[model samples]
Target: MAPTPFESLDDYISLPRIEALALSPDGTQAVLTVAVLKKDATAYERSLWTVPSDGSGAPRRLTRSAKGEAGAAFTARGDILFVSARPDADGEADDESGQLWLLPAGGGEARAVTRLAGGASQIAAVAEAADRLVIGAELLPGADSLEADAKLRALRKEKKVSAILHDAYPVRFWDHDLGPAEPHLLAIDLDTLEDTVAAVVAESDALATAAAAADTETDGATDAPADAGTPYPVTLPRPRDLTPAAHRTVDPDQVAVSPDGATVVASLQISEQRGGRFALVSIDVDSGERTTLFDEGDVDHEAPAMSHDGTRIAYLRSPRSTPEGPADVEVWTAGIDGSSPRRLAAGWDRWPTSLTFDRDDGALIATADSDGRGPVYRIPLDGSAPLQLTSDDFTYTHVAVDRFTGDLVALRSSWIAPPHPVRIGRDGAVAPLASPAPLPAAPATIGEVEATAEDGAPVRAWLLLPEGASDAAPAPLLLWIHGGPLSSWNAWSWRWNPLLAVARGYAVLLPDPALSTGYGLEFIARGWNSWGGKPYTDLMAITDAAVARPDIDETRTAAMGGSFGGYMANWVAGHTDRFRAIVTHASLWALDQFAGTTDSSVYWQRIFTPEAMTEHSPHRFVRDIRTPLLVIHGDRDYRVPIGESLRLWSELAEHHAAADGSTVHRFLYYPDENHWVLKPQHAVVWYQTVFAFLDEQLHGGEWHRPELLG
Candidate 1:
C-alpha cells in the first residue's frame, strides 16, 4: 500500500485510537475499546473490538452504536459485557445515561441487562459468578429503588431546578459539577433477571390488553399491534448499596471483586481533619460489613488488586503531599483476612502505575515509570529484587495478565506512536498485535538529549527534529514542557503533539526537569515547595543543552507549556528574555488564589500557604516579562481554573500598554473546552494558532490570525 500518505492535522485527529485492553479468563481472547471520531466530528464514539490473544486473526468489531460502548469485560462463560447509552428496543423508559448490556458468547444480539435510574458508569463482573456484577451509578440523597430515583429526577426537571446543596468539602470535580447526586456502588445479580423478565412480560400484556379495549371504544384510534414481539423488559433487582448511607459521600476511585464474588475491595476517600484520606477497605458482599484493610493517616492507598486464588490483596501506598517533602510509592500486599501485610519491591525507585498478580507463581507484575519510560516489572512476592521487563521508551497501561498462560496484554504508546495493543511473553519479548486501526508513520526523527542540571542532577529530554533539519539549514527550536509537574514526558500526547510542531518545521524539546516522575522521590522533593527555584533552573539548563545542537537554531527559540508546565512558562517569561515568544495554557498565575479556587483545593492548600504564594507565584514577577506571550485557557478548566489565565492576561495587558502599545500578547479562550482541548476542530485550531504566533515572532513574518477564529 503506497507508503501511507503523510498525516495531516485532520488525519492525526481522526485516527482511531485504542483506550484500554483486557484479556479473557481462559487467555484465548482479548478485547479493547477503539475510539473514533464521529461522522459530524463533534466527538469521539468508542466501540468494543475483540481479537484472538495469539494474534492469529484480525480484530473484529464487537459493539457498534451511535453512543458506542465502553468498560468491556468477558464473563466467566465467555460472554461479553459492556456499558453503553443505546436505547433499549422494548423502550420502557430510556435515558441518555449508560446502561449494562450483555452479548452472548454463542453469537446473538446483545440484550439490555440493567436499566438503573441514574445510569451505570462502570461495571465489573465477578470472575467466579458470571451472572453477578458490581456497578457504580449516581444516586439522589434519599432515593432507594430505580422508580423512586426516577421520580425525584422528574420532579427536579419539572421544577426547572439544577442547584445542588452540598454539605461537604468538594462540591465540584474537574471540569464538571459533582452533585445533585452522589456516586454510589451497587451489586446486581444477573441470574435473577429471569423473574424480572416474567414480571415485565405480564405488565406488557396488561398494557396491551388495555390499549386494545380502548381501541374498541374509540373506533380503532388506540389500537395496539397484534403481532408485537415479546417485550424483554428487564426489571433490575434492588441493588445493594456497597458504600452505604453513612459513607454515601465517599466516592471510590478503584474497586475490585474477589474471585469467589463474596468480597469487594475498594479505595474509598474518607474525610479527615486535614482535607481527606484514601483507604483500602474490604466489604463483605453479603453482610455489607466494611473492614479497613489498610489506612495510614498520612499516606493514601489506591489501586487494589486481588489475587486469582483470593488469598491476598495488593495495593499501592504513597504518602500524602505535605509542605515538607514529596513522597515515593510502594506496592504493599496483605492477606485476605487483613493480616501479615508486607511491602513488595521495598527498594524500588520507580512508582508502579498499575498492579496485577501472576496466576502461576503469584509474583507481582506491575507497570511503573522508570527512567522517562513506563515499563513493566515483575516483583516476586517473596521480597526478592524486582526484575525489569519490556525495556523501551514507551508507556504501557491497562495491563491484563492471562491467568492460564501468564501472557500479558497492554496498550502501549511512545513518542512516535499512538496507543496500540501488544502482547508480551513471560521472557520479556514484545510482539505487536494486529491493530484494528493502524497508526500513520512518525512525522519526524525522535532522539534524546541528556544534560546536567544546575545542582548536578541529570536531566533528560526527548528532541523531535523536523525532517530536513541539518547543520546547513537549522530548524528553530520550541521548548515544550509537560504538565503534572510530577509527570514525566514519557508517553505520546494526543493534545500537545510534538509531531504537529515538527510538521511546521520546528524542532521540539520535551524536557523532564525537577518534580518530573520516573526520577524517584528525591528529584520531586528538589522542587516540591519551591517550584521556581530548582525546577526552573533545571529546565533552563536542559534548554541550553538542546539549543546547542548543530541542527537547532539557538537564537530563534520559543517556549510553551500547559498546567504546571504552563506555570513554568509564565515564570520563564518574567525571568528571561531568551525566547522570542511563549505560550502558556491553563497556567497558575496568583498561587494564593489558585490554591483556594482550584478543583482540588485541599490538595494544593496542604503545601501552598499564603506566604509561599507571595514568594513563588508568577504574578509577583509579571512586570518583568518582556517577551511576546500567548495566553490560552478554557472556562471549564477547574483544575487550574480560568481565573489564573484571566489574571495573567490582565497583568500582561497592563504591562504591555505601559511599556509600549505593542500588541505582542494575545489570549485564546475556549468557553466549552476543559483543561485539554478535546474537540477535534478545537485542537486543530489550537495548533494552527500556536504555529501562526510562532511564525510571526521567530521568523519575523507578518502576523496572521488563524482563519478558524473569525
Candidate 2:
C-alpha cells in the first residue's frame, strides 16, 4: 500500500491523539484515552480505548460520550474505572463536574458510582484492596458533607458573588483561580457502595425526579416511596479527609496507597512561602493521622510509589536552586518505617520524570531526559549503577511495566511522528503496538547539529530540513526556542510544534541552551539568574552553526519562542538585528513586574531581587530592538500573565513610530485562551497568523491578516 500523504494544516490539527496509558494488573489489557475533534471541528473530545498488551489484535474503542472521559485505571478485580461528566441513564442533563464511573469486568454498561456535590477530579484504586478507592474532590471552606457543599455552592451562585477573599500567598494557578474551592483527598469504600449503586441504577428516573424536587425544597430533604418498589434506602459512608485542616489550603501533586490500603502517601506543598517546595506525608486511611515520611528544608520530594509488599517507598528528590547554582535530582528509597534512607543513581546526570517499582520490588524502572531524548532506565534497589534500557532519538512518557509478561509499554514520539504506544523489550528493542489511529508519514527529514558554547560546554540541537532543499535552493531558517528554560527539547510537543514550520518550507532549529536539563547541573548554572547572558550567547552560537549548513538560508532567518523562550526572543531582538523577524508569545518583558504579578509571585520573588530584575529584564533594552516583531498572548495566562505582552506591544509600537527604519510590529490577542491555545480552531488560527507574519517579514510578501480575526 502507498504511504499516507502529508496534507494541509487542517490534516495535521485533525489527527487523533492518545495519552495517559493504564495497564491492567494481569497485563493482558491496556487502556488509553484518545482525543479527536468533534463533528463540528470546534474542539476535541476524549474517549476511552483499549488494546491487547501482547499486540495480538488492533485497538478498539471502549466508551463513548459527548462529555468525554479520562483518568482510566484498572481495579484489582480487572474492572475499568474512569471519570466522566456524562448524564445519568435516565436522560437527565449532564453535570458540569466530573463523576466516577465503573465498567465491570463481566462487560456491562458503565454506571456512576459517586454522587458527590463537587464530583470527582482524580482517582486511584488500591493495589491490594479490590473494593477501596481514593478520590480527589473540591470543597468549600467549612463544608464537610456533600449535601452541605452543594447548598453552599447554590447560595453563592444565587447571590451572584464571584469574589474570593484571600488571606494566604497564591491566589491563582496556571490558568484558573484557586480560591473559592480547594482540593482534598477522600477515601471511599467501594464494597459498601455496591448496594447503593444497584438501587440508583434500578430507579434512576425516580431518583432524578426526587433530586429536581429537592433543589426547590428549602429543608434539603427528599421524599421517598414507602413500598417494596421504592428504592432501597441508599446511605453512603462518610469519606475521610486525609489532609490536615492547616494544610487543606495547599494542593497535592500525587497520591499513592499502601498495599494493605491502610495508609496513603501524598506529595503536597507544605510551605506557603517557598515556590514548589513539596514533602511526602503518610496518612492513615481510616484515622486520618498524618506522619512526615520525608521532609527537607532545602530539597523537594515528589512522585511517591509504594512497593507491592508495603515494605518500601521510593520517590524523587532535588535540592532547591540558589542564585549561584543549579541542583541535580536523585532517586531515594526508604523503608515504610522511615529507616535506612539512601539515594540511588546519585552519579547519573539524567533526571527522572516518572518512576514505578517492578513487580517483585527488586528494582525501579523510570523515564528520564538524556541528551536530546527521554529514555528508560533500570535502577536496582541494592544501590548498584543504573542501566540504560532504551537508546533512541525519540521521547517516551507514561511508562508502564506489564507484571504478567515483564514487558514495558510507553507512549513514544519523535520529530518525525506523533505519540503512539509501543512495547520495549529487555534488550531496548521497540515494536509499535496495534494502533487504530496511526499518524501520517513525515514530510521532512530531521538531523542533529552540535556546537561549543562560550564556556566550552557542549550545546546540541535538532535541525529539521525541508524534503527537497539542497545547496542550490536553501530553505529559510527559523530558530525556535523551547519553554521551561528548565526543560529539554527531548519530547514531542503539541503546542510549539516544529513540523508546522518545516511543512512551510523552513528549516527549524531546536536548541538546548545553558538552562536546559538532561545536561549536568553545571550547564544549568551557567544561565541561572542570568537569562540573557550565557543562554543568549549559546543560542546565537548554535544558530550560527546550523545556518552555516549548505541547505539553510542564513540571510532570511527568524527567531520565535514562548514563555522563557519568548523572553529570549525579546532578548535576541535587543541584542542582534541579524534575524529578519521575531515572534514572542506569553513572554516576560519587565522582570520586576512579572515577579510581582505572576501566579506564583512569592516563588519568583525568592529567586529574583529588584537589582537582579533591573539587570536581566528585557524591557530595559526595548529601545535597542531594530527587527520586525510579532507579539501573541492569551489574556487568561497567569504563569507569565498577559500584562507582559501588553507592555511589550505598547513599547514596540512606540519604538516603531519613532524609529526611521522599517520595523513593523503586530499583536495577536486571544481573549479566552490560557497559556495554550487548546481549541482546535484556535490552534489553526495561531499557526496561520504566525506564518503570515513570517512570510511578510522574510519573503517580502504583502501583509495579509487571517480572515478569522476579521
Best by lDDT: 1
lDDT tens per residue, model 2, 269-354? 77645354788888888788888888888788888888878888899888876666677788999987667899998888778888
Candidate lDDT (C-alpha), each: 0.82, 0.81
Model 2 TM-score (2 dp): 0.93
lDDT of 2: 0.81
Give lDDT tens digits, candidate 1, residues 164-281. 8867766667788877777777887666655356777776776686557545554323223323222223454556778755333355447878877788888888786435778888
Candidate 1 wrongly placed segments (more than 4 Å): 1-7, 92-94, 128-130, 195-199, 203-238, 246-252, 658-662
